[model samples]
Target: MDMIVQSLRLGEIEIPEEKLIYMERPVLGFEDYKQFCLIEIDEFKPFLWLQSTEKPAVAFLVVNPKIFVSDYKIEINSKEIAELDIENVNSVETYVVVTLSDKIENMTINLQGPILINTENQRGKQLVLVNSDYEVNYKFMTHTVEEETEVNREVPVEV
Candidate 1:
């Protein structure tokens, strides 16, 4: 089924259309949050807020693994893919949960657990990186959320 993209809100944050990062699975504890859009309150940085149309109140702060542990990889099972009806890997969007800090730049992402979604079908899943050496919070220093938003506006983020 072709899932329609809808606007979402989290707390006082408004997740824009330009911030969406599609994935292959509609994550657990979030079966309702299928089609999610990602927003970076700070750009060139590692922290972002996730908002799904299915559950507007549901928003998560996430980061990229590349920012922290340079060599992090997540192993997904075939059964999980089949469950989400995922065919192409490109359709999946991955986001690591983030735990904020007093110093925004010091914020860390949860690499040990990652949220994956199939944008094509609006399916999502939050899987544990049990076999990998990843942390719940991986810290990094980069641009502000506003900066990232500006860049995304200039150039569309693909897949």
Candidate 2:
């Protein structure tokens, strides 16, 4: 059965009951909200909203880390897999929360911790990587400032 949910990001929308995810370990700083739904809109191709059903005003921008880092991978311990009731690795989906910067060029994603969900059971958990070089604030968009070198500087020549 489909249920109507009010989202601040998308306004009132109807979501299927199967699409509802129950978080075993809710997102950091949002422990009170265990029920959430992932909303994807075409306009925001690379980003999706993890809207909290409990609180319509609360939503998170999340994306698959692989979208930015094609080689992104994580090892899930047996404990985590069992907790999520993940039968097979293929049933798991990973999403990282995106932190938007005032300047779009500076936007970054949290790779150190990722939200893993089991599609079969609709259960999710956020895992914090303990033995990894993944940065908490990994910048996906590469931006650099041009340097002013002496050789390139304009020199005034005597007439």
Q: In every candidate, how many clashes are there? A: 23, 0
For candidate 1, write residues 1-159 as lDDT tens digits: 333434354344444454454444455566655566665654534566667656656777766554454445566777777866778877666667876689878876777677776667666677776776666665654523334333321111122
User: Candidate 1 has what TM-score?
Assistant: 0.59
lDDT, candidate 1, at 80: 77
Off by over 4 Å in 1: 1-36, 39-47, 52-57, 142-159
Q: Lowest lDDT 10-mer window, candidate 1?
A: 150-159
Model 2, 45-121: lDDT tens digits are 66799989999998999987776765577887778867888767777778999999998878899988888878898
Q: How accurate is candidate 2 locally (lDDT)?
A: 0.81
Error of 1 at 44 (Å): 8.0
List runs of model 2 lying over 4 Å from the truth: 143-159
Question: Evaluated with TM-score, which candidate comes out highest?
Answer: 2
